[model samples]
Target: MKLHGYFRSSASYRVRIALNLKGLSAEHLSHHLRKGEQRAADYLAINPQGFVPTVQGDGANLTQSLAIIEWLDETHPEPPLLPKEPLRRARVRAFAQVIACDTHPIQNLKILARLRELGLPEEKVTEWAAWANREGLAACEK
Candidate 1:
Protein backbone atom coordinates (compact mmCIF):
# COMPACT_ATOMS: atom_id res chain seq x y z
CA MET A 1 0.00 0.00 0.00
CA LYS A 2 1.06 3.57 -0.67
CA LEU A 3 -0.20 6.88 0.70
CA HIS A 4 0.25 10.03 -1.36
CA GLY A 5 -0.20 13.12 0.77
CA TYR A 6 1.32 16.28 2.17
CA PHE A 7 2.86 16.33 5.64
CA ARG A 8 0.92 19.28 7.02
CA SER A 9 -2.47 18.28 5.63
CA SER A 10 -5.03 17.45 8.34
CA ALA A 11 -6.81 15.07 5.98
CA SER A 12 -3.60 13.16 5.48
CA TYR A 13 -2.94 13.21 9.21
CA ARG A 14 -6.34 11.66 9.86
CA VAL A 15 -5.58 8.84 7.44
CA ARG A 16 -2.20 8.33 9.06
CA ILE A 17 -3.80 7.94 12.45
CA ALA A 18 -6.34 5.50 11.04
CA LEU A 19 -3.64 3.44 9.40
CA ASN A 20 -1.71 3.35 12.64
CA LEU A 21 -4.75 2.33 14.64
CA LYS A 22 -5.49 -0.42 12.13
CA GLY A 23 -1.91 -1.69 12.35
CA LEU A 24 -1.57 -1.20 8.63
CA SER A 25 1.58 0.07 6.98
CA ALA A 26 1.90 1.84 3.67
CA GLU A 27 4.74 3.45 1.79
CA HIS A 28 4.70 7.19 2.38
CA LEU A 29 4.84 9.41 -0.67
CA SER A 30 4.91 13.12 -0.03
CA HIS A 31 3.46 15.67 -2.42
CA HIS A 32 4.48 19.19 -1.51
CA LEU A 33 1.10 20.93 -1.65
CA ARG A 34 2.64 24.36 -1.18
CA LYS A 35 4.71 23.73 -4.29
CA GLY A 36 1.63 22.47 -6.18
CA GLU A 37 3.08 19.05 -6.76
CA GLN A 38 -0.36 17.53 -6.46
CA ARG A 39 -1.36 19.06 -9.78
CA ALA A 40 1.21 17.10 -11.70
CA ALA A 41 -0.10 14.84 -14.47
CA ASP A 42 1.04 11.65 -12.78
CA TYR A 43 -0.78 12.38 -9.57
CA LEU A 44 -3.82 13.67 -11.42
CA ALA A 45 -4.05 10.31 -13.11
CA ILE A 46 -4.11 8.62 -9.71
CA ASN A 47 -6.51 11.08 -8.11
CA PRO A 48 -8.41 13.43 -10.36
CA GLN A 49 -9.44 15.56 -7.40
CA GLY A 50 -5.77 16.35 -6.80
CA PHE A 51 -6.25 16.09 -3.08
CA VAL A 52 -3.93 14.52 -0.58
CA PRO A 53 -4.34 11.19 1.27
CA THR A 54 -4.92 9.02 -1.81
CA VAL A 55 -4.29 5.41 -1.02
CA GLN A 56 -3.00 3.08 -3.75
CA GLY A 57 -3.67 -0.49 -2.72
CA ASP A 58 -5.54 -3.70 -3.50
CA GLY A 59 -5.38 -2.79 -7.18
CA ALA A 60 -7.46 0.31 -6.52
CA ASN A 61 -6.72 3.91 -5.75
CA LEU A 62 -8.86 5.52 -3.08
CA THR A 63 -9.36 9.22 -2.51
CA GLN A 64 -11.13 11.10 0.29
CA SER A 65 -9.80 10.52 3.78
CA LEU A 66 -13.10 9.48 5.31
CA ALA A 67 -13.74 6.94 2.58
CA ILE A 68 -10.23 5.56 2.90
CA ILE A 69 -10.54 5.29 6.66
CA GLU A 70 -13.90 3.57 6.39
CA TRP A 71 -12.47 1.15 3.81
CA LEU A 72 -9.62 0.37 6.16
CA ASP A 73 -12.00 -0.20 9.03
CA GLU A 74 -14.15 -2.49 6.90
CA THR A 75 -11.23 -4.48 5.53
CA HIS A 76 -9.52 -4.77 8.89
CA PRO A 77 -12.22 -5.21 11.50
CA GLU A 78 -10.06 -6.22 14.46
CA PRO A 79 -10.15 -2.69 15.90
CA PRO A 80 -13.43 -1.24 14.75
CA LEU A 81 -13.58 2.51 14.28
CA LEU A 82 -17.37 2.79 13.89
CA PRO A 83 -20.09 1.59 16.22
CA LYS A 84 -22.30 -1.36 15.28
CA GLU A 85 -25.52 0.31 16.31
CA PRO A 86 -27.10 2.20 13.40
CA LEU A 87 -28.01 5.35 15.27
CA ARG A 88 -24.67 5.58 17.07
CA ARG A 89 -22.85 4.97 13.78
CA ALA A 90 -24.77 7.77 12.09
CA ARG A 91 -23.92 10.14 14.93
CA VAL A 92 -20.25 9.27 14.78
CA ARG A 93 -20.18 9.82 11.02
CA ALA A 94 -21.94 13.13 11.38
CA PHE A 95 -19.40 14.27 13.97
CA ALA A 96 -16.52 13.24 11.75
CA GLN A 97 -18.05 15.02 8.77
CA VAL A 98 -18.40 18.16 10.85
CA ILE A 99 -14.67 18.18 11.41
CA ALA A 100 -13.52 16.90 8.03
CA CYS A 101 -16.00 18.57 5.71
CA ASP A 102 -16.78 21.73 7.65
CA THR A 103 -13.74 22.79 9.66
CA HIS A 104 -10.83 21.39 7.67
CA PRO A 105 -11.93 22.61 4.23
CA ILE A 106 -12.11 26.22 5.35
CA GLN A 107 -8.63 26.01 6.86
CA ASN A 108 -7.09 23.96 4.07
CA LEU A 109 -3.98 25.20 2.31
CA LYS A 110 -5.66 25.62 -1.08
CA ILE A 111 -8.47 27.74 0.35
CA LEU A 112 -6.02 29.88 2.30
CA ALA A 113 -3.92 30.34 -0.83
CA ARG A 114 -6.97 31.35 -2.81
CA LEU A 115 -7.92 33.81 -0.10
CA ARG A 116 -4.49 35.39 -0.38
CA GLU A 117 -4.74 35.46 -4.17
CA LEU A 118 -8.06 37.23 -3.83
CA GLY A 119 -6.26 40.06 -1.98
CA LEU A 120 -7.39 39.18 1.51
CA PRO A 121 -4.95 40.40 4.13
CA GLU A 122 -3.02 37.86 6.17
CA GLU A 123 -4.82 38.81 9.36
CA LYS A 124 -8.18 38.41 7.71
CA VAL A 125 -7.24 35.02 6.33
CA THR A 126 -6.11 33.86 9.73
CA GLU A 127 -9.28 35.20 11.26
CA TRP A 128 -11.41 33.33 8.76
CA ALA A 129 -9.67 30.08 9.50
CA ALA A 130 -9.93 30.62 13.22
CA TRP A 131 -13.59 31.54 13.03
CA ALA A 132 -14.43 28.54 10.90
CA ASN A 133 -12.64 26.22 13.28
CA ARG A 134 -14.26 27.76 16.31
CA GLU A 135 -17.77 27.58 14.90
CA GLY A 136 -17.41 24.08 13.52
CA LEU A 137 -15.93 22.72 16.71
CA ALA A 138 -18.57 24.46 18.80
CA ALA A 139 -21.30 22.86 16.71
CA CYS A 140 -19.64 19.47 17.03
CA GLU A 141 -19.48 19.90 20.81
CA LYS A 142 -23.18 20.64 20.88
Candidate 2:
Protein backbone atom coordinates (compact mmCIF):
# COMPACT_ATOMS: atom_id res chain seq x y z
CA MET A 1 0.00 0.00 0.00
CA LYS A 2 1.05 3.56 -0.70
CA LEU A 3 0.01 6.72 1.11
CA HIS A 4 0.45 10.05 -0.65
CA GLY A 5 0.25 12.92 1.76
CA TYR A 6 1.75 16.08 3.18
CA PHE A 7 3.25 15.78 6.61
CA ARG A 8 1.34 18.72 8.02
CA SER A 9 -2.07 17.76 6.66
CA SER A 10 -4.51 16.93 9.48
CA ALA A 11 -6.30 14.50 7.18
CA SER A 12 -3.05 12.72 6.50
CA TYR A 13 -2.26 12.66 10.22
CA ARG A 14 -5.60 10.97 10.94
CA VAL A 15 -4.96 8.32 8.30
CA ARG A 16 -1.49 7.67 9.64
CA ILE A 17 -2.91 7.19 13.12
CA ALA A 18 -5.52 4.79 11.82
CA LEU A 19 -2.91 2.80 9.88
CA ASN A 20 -0.74 2.56 12.97
CA LEU A 21 -3.69 1.47 15.09
CA LYS A 22 -4.52 -1.25 12.57
CA GLY A 23 -0.89 -2.41 12.51
CA LEU A 24 -0.73 -1.60 8.81
CA SER A 25 2.37 -0.09 7.32
CA ALA A 26 2.15 1.58 3.95
CA GLU A 27 4.87 3.08 1.83
CA HIS A 28 4.95 6.76 2.71
CA LEU A 29 5.04 9.22 -0.18
CA SER A 30 5.20 12.92 0.51
CA HIS A 31 3.73 15.65 -1.65
CA HIS A 32 4.83 19.13 -0.73
CA LEU A 33 1.55 20.99 -0.47
CA ARG A 34 3.14 24.40 -0.04
CA LYS A 35 5.04 23.84 -3.29
CA GLY A 36 1.90 22.65 -5.08
CA GLU A 37 3.27 19.18 -5.67
CA GLN A 38 -0.20 17.71 -5.15
CA ARG A 39 -1.50 19.58 -8.21
CA ALA A 40 1.01 17.99 -10.53
CA ALA A 41 -0.37 16.04 -13.47
CA ASP A 42 0.63 12.59 -12.26
CA TYR A 43 -0.83 13.09 -8.79
CA LEU A 44 -3.97 14.70 -10.16
CA ALA A 45 -4.52 11.71 -12.43
CA ILE A 46 -4.77 9.54 -9.34
CA ASN A 47 -6.54 12.03 -7.09
CA PRO A 48 -8.63 14.62 -8.87
CA GLN A 49 -9.21 16.57 -5.67
CA GLY A 50 -5.48 17.26 -5.30
CA PHE A 51 -5.76 16.61 -1.60
CA VAL A 52 -3.56 14.61 0.72
CA PRO A 53 -4.10 11.16 2.27
CA THR A 54 -4.75 9.24 -0.94
CA VAL A 55 -4.20 5.52 -0.60
CA GLN A 56 -3.34 3.20 -3.47
CA GLY A 57 -3.77 -0.49 -2.84
CA ASP A 58 -5.92 -3.51 -3.65
CA GLY A 59 -6.41 -2.14 -7.15
CA ALA A 60 -8.21 0.83 -5.62
CA ASN A 61 -7.32 4.47 -5.17
CA LEU A 62 -9.03 6.07 -2.20
CA THR A 63 -9.26 9.73 -1.20
CA GLN A 64 -10.92 11.44 1.75
CA SER A 65 -9.34 10.45 5.03
CA LEU A 66 -12.52 9.35 6.78
CA ALA A 67 -13.49 7.05 3.93
CA ILE A 68 -9.98 5.67 3.71
CA ILE A 69 -9.86 5.04 7.47
CA GLU A 70 -13.25 3.34 7.35
CA TRP A 71 -12.01 1.17 4.49
CA LEU A 72 -9.01 0.19 6.53
CA ASP A 73 -11.26 -0.68 9.46
CA GLU A 74 -13.44 -2.79 7.20
CA THR A 75 -10.52 -4.58 5.56
CA HIS A 76 -8.37 -5.04 8.63
CA PRO A 77 -10.99 -5.35 11.37
CA GLU A 78 -8.47 -6.15 14.08
CA PRO A 79 -8.67 -2.94 16.12
CA PRO A 80 -11.90 -1.43 14.88
CA LEU A 81 -12.14 2.37 14.56
CA LEU A 82 -15.92 2.47 14.83
CA PRO A 83 -18.25 0.81 17.26
CA LYS A 84 -20.05 -2.39 16.26
CA GLU A 85 -23.49 -1.03 17.11
CA PRO A 86 -25.14 1.03 14.37
CA LEU A 87 -26.32 4.04 16.39
CA ARG A 88 -23.10 4.30 18.29
CA ARG A 89 -21.18 4.09 15.02
CA ALA A 90 -23.25 6.90 13.61
CA ARG A 91 -22.52 9.06 16.65
CA VAL A 92 -18.82 8.41 16.28
CA ARG A 93 -18.88 9.30 12.61
CA ALA A 94 -20.88 12.44 13.32
CA PHE A 95 -18.37 13.53 15.92
CA ALA A 96 -15.53 12.96 13.49
CA GLN A 97 -17.32 14.95 10.83
CA VAL A 98 -17.75 17.83 13.27
CA ILE A 99 -14.01 18.11 13.60
CA ALA A 100 -12.93 17.18 10.07
CA CYS A 101 -15.59 19.04 8.12
CA ASP A 102 -16.83 21.86 10.32
CA THR A 103 -13.74 22.88 12.29
CA HIS A 104 -10.64 22.00 10.31
CA PRO A 105 -11.67 23.59 7.03
CA ILE A 106 -11.88 27.07 8.49
CA GLN A 107 -8.19 27.03 9.41
CA ASN A 108 -6.76 24.59 6.88
CA LEU A 109 -3.58 25.44 5.02
CA LYS A 110 -5.29 26.37 1.78
CA ILE A 111 -7.89 28.56 3.44
CA LEU A 112 -5.26 30.32 5.53
CA ALA A 113 -3.21 30.90 2.41
CA ARG A 114 -6.18 32.45 0.70
CA LEU A 115 -6.80 34.62 3.71
CA ARG A 116 -3.24 35.90 3.49
CA GLU A 117 -3.53 36.51 -0.23
CA LEU A 118 -6.69 38.49 0.36
CA GLY A 119 -4.77 40.87 2.65
CA LEU A 120 -6.33 39.83 5.89
CA PRO A 121 -4.21 41.11 8.75
CA GLU A 122 -2.22 38.48 10.60
CA GLU A 123 -3.89 39.24 13.94
CA LYS A 124 -7.31 39.13 12.32
CA VAL A 125 -6.56 35.82 10.68
CA THR A 126 -5.42 34.37 13.96
CA GLU A 127 -8.52 35.63 15.67
CA TRP A 128 -10.74 34.18 12.96
CA ALA A 129 -9.13 30.78 13.23
CA ALA A 130 -9.39 30.76 17.00
CA TRP A 131 -13.02 31.80 16.87
CA ALA A 132 -13.85 29.11 14.36
CA ASN A 133 -12.15 26.45 16.42
CA ARG A 134 -13.79 27.58 19.63
CA GLU A 135 -17.24 27.68 18.09
CA GLY A 136 -16.86 24.28 16.51
CA LEU A 137 -15.58 22.74 19.69
CA ALA A 138 -18.35 24.26 21.74
CA ALA A 139 -20.98 22.89 19.38
CA CYS A 140 -19.39 19.44 19.43
CA GLU A 141 -19.24 19.47 23.21
CA LYS A 142 -22.92 20.20 23.44
Candidate 3:
Protein backbone atom coordinates (compact mmCIF):
# COMPACT_ATOMS: atom_id res chain seq x y z
CA MET A 1 0.00 0.00 0.00
CA LYS A 2 1.09 3.53 -0.75
CA LEU A 3 -0.20 6.73 0.86
CA HIS A 4 0.17 9.94 -1.10
CA GLY A 5 -0.08 12.81 1.34
CA TYR A 6 1.12 16.24 2.31
CA PHE A 7 2.85 16.99 5.60
CA ARG A 8 0.75 19.89 6.87
CA SER A 9 -2.61 18.68 5.59
CA SER A 10 -4.98 17.99 8.48
CA ALA A 11 -6.72 15.33 6.41
CA SER A 12 -3.42 13.61 5.91
CA TYR A 13 -2.64 13.93 9.62
CA ARG A 14 -5.92 12.23 10.49
CA VAL A 15 -5.11 9.37 8.12
CA ARG A 16 -1.66 9.01 9.64
CA ILE A 17 -3.18 8.77 13.09
CA ALA A 18 -5.65 6.15 11.89
CA LEU A 19 -2.91 4.12 10.23
CA ASN A 20 -0.85 4.27 13.41
CA LEU A 21 -3.82 3.21 15.50
CA LYS A 22 -4.49 0.31 13.15
CA GLY A 23 -0.81 -0.67 13.05
CA LEU A 24 -1.06 -0.83 9.30
CA SER A 25 2.10 -0.44 7.30
CA ALA A 26 2.12 1.52 4.07
CA GLU A 27 4.65 3.38 1.98
CA HIS A 28 4.45 7.11 2.54
CA LEU A 29 4.84 9.38 -0.43
CA SER A 30 4.88 13.05 0.36
CA HIS A 31 3.57 15.50 -2.20
CA HIS A 32 4.93 18.96 -1.48
CA LEU A 33 1.73 21.01 -1.78
CA ARG A 34 3.53 24.23 -0.92
CA LYS A 35 5.66 23.62 -3.99
CA GLY A 36 2.61 22.83 -6.15
CA GLU A 37 3.66 19.22 -6.61
CA GLN A 38 0.04 18.13 -6.41
CA ARG A 39 -0.68 19.95 -9.63
CA ALA A 40 1.72 17.85 -11.62
CA ALA A 41 0.18 15.91 -14.46
CA ASP A 42 1.17 12.52 -13.07
CA TYR A 43 -0.26 13.16 -9.63
CA LEU A 44 -3.39 14.74 -11.11
CA ALA A 45 -3.91 11.63 -13.17
CA ILE A 46 -3.76 9.60 -9.99
CA ASN A 47 -6.13 11.95 -8.16
CA PRO A 48 -8.10 14.31 -10.32
CA GLN A 49 -9.21 16.12 -7.23
CA GLY A 50 -5.54 17.01 -6.71
CA PHE A 51 -5.78 16.57 -2.99
CA VAL A 52 -3.60 14.73 -0.54
CA PRO A 53 -4.22 11.58 1.49
CA THR A 54 -4.85 9.20 -1.38
CA VAL A 55 -4.46 5.57 -0.31
CA GLN A 56 -3.63 2.90 -2.83
CA GLY A 57 -4.97 -0.44 -1.70
CA ASP A 58 -5.54 -3.76 -3.44
CA GLY A 59 -6.74 -2.81 -6.92
CA ALA A 60 -8.36 0.32 -5.51
CA ASN A 61 -7.39 3.87 -4.67
CA LEU A 62 -9.21 5.59 -1.84
CA THR A 63 -9.45 9.34 -1.61
CA GLN A 64 -10.92 11.21 1.34
CA SER A 65 -9.52 10.51 4.80
CA LEU A 66 -12.83 9.57 6.39
CA ALA A 67 -13.49 6.97 3.71
CA ILE A 68 -10.02 5.59 4.08
CA ILE A 69 -10.38 5.37 7.84
CA GLU A 70 -13.73 3.62 7.50
CA TRP A 71 -12.20 1.16 5.08
CA LEU A 72 -9.36 0.51 7.51
CA ASP A 73 -11.71 -0.07 10.43
CA GLU A 74 -13.93 -2.31 8.33
CA THR A 75 -11.12 -4.35 6.77
CA HIS A 76 -8.94 -4.48 9.92
CA PRO A 77 -11.39 -4.99 12.77
CA GLU A 78 -9.15 -5.24 15.80
CA PRO A 79 -9.18 -2.20 18.10
CA PRO A 80 -12.40 -0.92 16.68
CA LEU A 81 -12.65 2.85 16.41
CA LEU A 82 -16.42 3.04 16.09
CA PRO A 83 -18.76 1.89 18.77
CA LYS A 84 -20.86 -1.24 18.12
CA GLU A 85 -24.22 0.30 18.89
CA PRO A 86 -25.94 1.77 15.84
CA LEU A 87 -26.82 4.99 17.64
CA ARG A 88 -23.29 5.37 18.91
CA ARG A 89 -21.95 4.83 15.43
CA ALA A 90 -24.28 7.48 14.09
CA ARG A 91 -23.24 9.96 16.75
CA VAL A 92 -19.55 9.32 16.18
CA ARG A 93 -19.91 9.68 12.46
CA ALA A 94 -21.87 12.88 12.91
CA PHE A 95 -19.22 14.28 15.21
CA ALA A 96 -16.47 13.46 12.77
CA GLN A 97 -18.41 14.98 9.90
CA VAL A 98 -18.86 18.14 11.91
CA ILE A 99 -15.15 18.64 11.83
CA ALA A 100 -14.58 17.12 8.40
CA CYS A 101 -17.36 18.75 6.40
CA ASP A 102 -18.19 21.85 8.40
CA THR A 103 -14.91 23.18 9.77
CA HIS A 104 -12.26 21.84 7.39
CA PRO A 105 -13.60 23.01 4.06
CA ILE A 106 -13.73 26.67 5.02
CA GLN A 107 -10.18 26.83 6.35
CA ASN A 108 -8.64 24.71 3.65
CA LEU A 109 -5.75 26.21 1.69
CA LYS A 110 -7.86 26.95 -1.36
CA ILE A 111 -10.50 28.82 0.62
CA LEU A 112 -7.87 30.74 2.55
CA ALA A 113 -6.16 31.62 -0.70
CA ARG A 114 -9.44 32.85 -2.12
CA LEU A 115 -9.98 35.02 0.92
CA ARG A 116 -6.52 36.52 0.51
CA GLU A 117 -7.11 37.03 -3.19
CA LEU A 118 -10.23 38.97 -2.33
CA GLY A 119 -8.06 41.30 -0.21
CA LEU A 120 -9.46 40.15 3.09
CA PRO A 121 -7.29 41.28 5.99
CA GLU A 122 -5.18 38.89 7.99
CA GLU A 123 -7.40 39.60 10.99
CA LYS A 124 -10.42 38.44 9.01
CA VAL A 125 -8.61 35.29 8.04
CA THR A 126 -7.80 34.64 11.70
CA GLU A 127 -11.40 35.29 12.61
CA TRP A 128 -12.59 32.90 9.97
CA ALA A 129 -10.39 30.13 11.32
CA ALA A 130 -11.52 30.78 14.88
CA TRP A 131 -15.13 30.75 13.79
CA ALA A 132 -14.68 27.43 12.07
CA ASN A 133 -13.12 25.90 15.17
CA ARG A 134 -15.84 27.23 17.41
CA GLU A 135 -18.60 25.98 15.17
CA GLY A 136 -16.99 22.60 14.79
CA LEU A 137 -16.57 22.19 18.53
CA ALA A 138 -20.14 23.26 19.18
CA ALA A 139 -21.39 20.78 16.63
CA CYS A 140 -19.31 18.04 18.18
CA GLU A 141 -20.73 18.84 21.61
CA LYS A 142 -24.23 18.50 20.30
Candidate 4:
Protein backbone atom coordinates (compact mmCIF):
# COMPACT_ATOMS: atom_id res chain seq x y z
CA MET A 1 0.00 0.00 0.00
CA LYS A 2 1.16 3.50 -0.67
CA LEU A 3 -0.09 6.70 0.89
CA HIS A 4 0.74 9.84 -1.04
CA GLY A 5 0.48 12.94 1.06
CA TYR A 6 2.21 15.88 2.66
CA PHE A 7 3.09 15.77 6.35
CA ARG A 8 1.37 19.08 6.97
CA SER A 9 -1.91 18.05 5.40
CA SER A 10 -4.68 17.58 7.96
CA ALA A 11 -6.38 15.12 5.66
CA SER A 12 -3.21 13.10 5.54
CA TYR A 13 -3.02 13.21 9.32
CA ARG A 14 -6.50 11.76 9.64
CA VAL A 15 -5.59 8.78 7.48
CA ARG A 16 -2.35 8.20 9.36
CA ILE A 17 -4.20 8.22 12.66
CA ALA A 18 -6.66 5.62 11.48
CA LEU A 19 -3.92 3.50 10.00
CA ASN A 20 -2.05 3.57 13.31
CA LEU A 21 -5.10 2.52 15.32
CA LYS A 22 -5.80 -0.25 12.84
CA GLY A 23 -2.25 -1.54 12.97
CA LEU A 24 -1.76 -0.77 9.31
CA SER A 25 1.20 0.78 7.55
CA ALA A 26 1.73 2.01 4.06
CA GLU A 27 4.63 3.33 2.06
CA HIS A 28 4.28 7.00 2.81
CA LEU A 29 5.32 9.33 0.02
CA SER A 30 5.32 12.96 1.00
CA HIS A 31 4.92 15.68 -1.55
CA HIS A 32 5.95 19.01 -0.14
CA LEU A 33 2.72 20.99 -0.21
CA ARG A 34 4.30 24.41 0.22
CA LYS A 35 6.68 23.70 -2.67
CA GLY A 36 3.81 22.78 -5.00
CA GLU A 37 5.13 19.28 -5.48
CA GLN A 38 1.63 17.90 -5.44
CA ARG A 39 1.01 19.42 -8.85
CA ALA A 40 3.75 17.36 -10.42
CA ALA A 41 2.68 15.38 -13.47
CA ASP A 42 3.40 12.02 -11.88
CA TYR A 43 1.27 12.77 -8.84
CA LEU A 44 -1.42 14.37 -10.96
CA ALA A 45 -1.76 11.21 -13.03
CA ILE A 46 -2.63 9.24 -9.93
CA ASN A 47 -4.87 11.95 -8.54
CA PRO A 48 -6.15 14.40 -11.07
CA GLN A 49 -7.21 16.73 -8.28
CA GLY A 50 -3.66 16.71 -6.91
CA PHE A 51 -4.82 16.55 -3.33
CA VAL A 52 -3.11 14.84 -0.45
CA PRO A 53 -4.14 11.68 1.42
CA THR A 54 -4.50 9.52 -1.68
CA VAL A 55 -4.21 5.78 -1.15
CA GLN A 56 -3.17 3.33 -3.83
CA GLY A 57 -3.63 -0.32 -2.94
CA ASP A 58 -5.68 -3.44 -3.53
CA GLY A 59 -6.20 -2.53 -7.16
CA ALA A 60 -7.86 0.63 -5.98
CA ASN A 61 -6.84 4.24 -5.91
CA LEU A 62 -8.75 6.38 -3.47
CA THR A 63 -8.69 10.07 -2.62
CA GLN A 64 -10.45 12.29 -0.12
CA SER A 65 -9.62 11.79 3.53
CA LEU A 66 -13.14 11.07 4.77
CA ALA A 67 -13.74 8.49 2.07
CA ILE A 68 -10.42 6.82 2.76
CA ILE A 69 -11.09 6.71 6.49
CA GLU A 70 -14.52 5.25 5.95
CA TRP A 71 -13.11 2.68 3.55
CA LEU A 72 -10.54 1.69 6.13
CA ASP A 73 -13.17 1.27 8.77
CA GLU A 74 -15.34 -0.77 6.47
CA THR A 75 -12.54 -3.01 5.29
CA HIS A 76 -10.61 -3.48 8.52
CA PRO A 77 -13.66 -3.71 10.82
CA GLU A 78 -11.56 -4.29 13.92
CA PRO A 79 -11.50 -1.44 16.41
CA PRO A 80 -14.05 0.30 14.25
CA LEU A 81 -13.68 4.04 13.92
CA LEU A 82 -17.34 5.01 13.66
CA PRO A 83 -20.03 4.08 16.13
CA LYS A 84 -22.26 1.21 15.09
CA GLU A 85 -25.39 2.89 16.30
CA PRO A 86 -26.99 4.90 13.53
CA LEU A 87 -27.74 8.22 15.24
CA ARG A 88 -24.40 8.52 16.98
CA ARG A 89 -22.67 7.48 13.78
CA ALA A 90 -24.48 10.15 11.83
CA ARG A 91 -23.52 12.76 14.40
CA VAL A 92 -19.90 11.70 14.24
CA ARG A 93 -19.87 11.87 10.45
CA ALA A 94 -21.43 15.33 10.64
CA PHE A 95 -18.70 16.52 12.97
CA ALA A 96 -15.99 15.10 10.77
CA GLN A 97 -17.46 16.72 7.70
CA VAL A 98 -17.72 20.02 9.54
CA ILE A 99 -13.97 19.99 10.00
CA ALA A 100 -12.87 18.27 6.80
CA CYS A 101 -15.31 19.77 4.37
CA ASP A 102 -16.78 22.95 5.82
CA THR A 103 -13.88 24.51 7.66
CA HIS A 104 -10.64 23.32 6.11
CA PRO A 105 -11.15 24.51 2.56
CA ILE A 106 -11.85 28.20 3.08
CA GLN A 107 -8.43 28.90 4.59
CA ASN A 108 -6.54 26.05 2.95
CA LEU A 109 -3.28 26.70 1.12
CA LYS A 110 -4.90 26.79 -2.31
CA ILE A 111 -7.48 29.35 -1.35
CA LEU A 112 -4.99 31.43 0.57
CA ALA A 113 -2.59 31.29 -2.36
CA ARG A 114 -5.33 32.46 -4.68
CA LEU A 115 -6.10 35.26 -2.28
CA ARG A 116 -2.49 36.34 -2.38
CA GLU A 117 -2.52 36.15 -6.18
CA LEU A 118 -5.56 38.40 -6.20
CA GLY A 119 -3.51 41.07 -4.42
CA LEU A 120 -5.03 40.65 -0.98
CA PRO A 121 -2.56 42.04 1.56
CA GLU A 122 -0.86 39.59 3.89
CA GLU A 123 -2.63 41.02 6.91
CA LYS A 124 -5.97 40.69 5.17
CA VAL A 125 -5.19 37.14 4.24
CA THR A 126 -4.34 36.30 7.81
CA GLU A 127 -7.52 37.95 8.97
CA TRP A 128 -9.54 35.95 6.49
CA ALA A 129 -7.98 32.72 7.65
CA ALA A 130 -8.60 33.58 11.29
CA TRP A 131 -12.22 34.41 10.60
CA ALA A 132 -12.79 31.18 8.72
CA ASN A 133 -11.10 29.11 11.41
CA ARG A 134 -12.95 30.86 14.19
CA GLU A 135 -16.32 30.45 12.55
CA GLY A 136 -15.80 26.78 11.69
CA LEU A 137 -14.33 25.90 15.06
CA ALA A 138 -17.15 27.65 16.84
CA ALA A 139 -19.63 25.51 14.96
CA CYS A 140 -17.72 22.37 15.75
CA GLU A 141 -17.54 23.37 19.39
CA LYS A 142 -21.29 23.76 19.65
How many clashing residue pairs, candidate 3?
0
The TM-score of candidate 2 is 0.89
By TM-score, highest first, what's the ranking? 4, 1, 3, 2
Q: Model 1 lDDT vs. the true structure?
A: 0.93
Clash counts for all predictions: 0, 0, 0, 0
Misplaced by over 4 Å in model 4 are none
As for lDDT, the candidate ahead, 2 or 3, is 2
Candidate 1 lDDT over 15-106, as tens digits, reads: 99999999999999999998999989999999998889899999979999999999999899979998899999999999999999888988
lDDT of 3 at 79: 86
User: In model 2, how large is the Cα lDDT of residue 79?
Assistant: 88
Runs in model 3 lying further than 4 Å from the true structure: none
Error of 3 at 83 (Å): 1.0
lDDT for each residue of candidate 4 in 1-142, tens digit (9 for 90 to 100): 8999888898899999999999999999999999999899999998888789899999999999999999999999999998889999999999998989889988999999999999999999999999999999999888
Regarding TM-score, does 2 or 4 come out ahead?
4
Higher-ranked by TM-score: 1 or 4 = 4
Off by over 4 Å in 1: none
For candidate 3, the per-residue lDDT at 141 reads 75
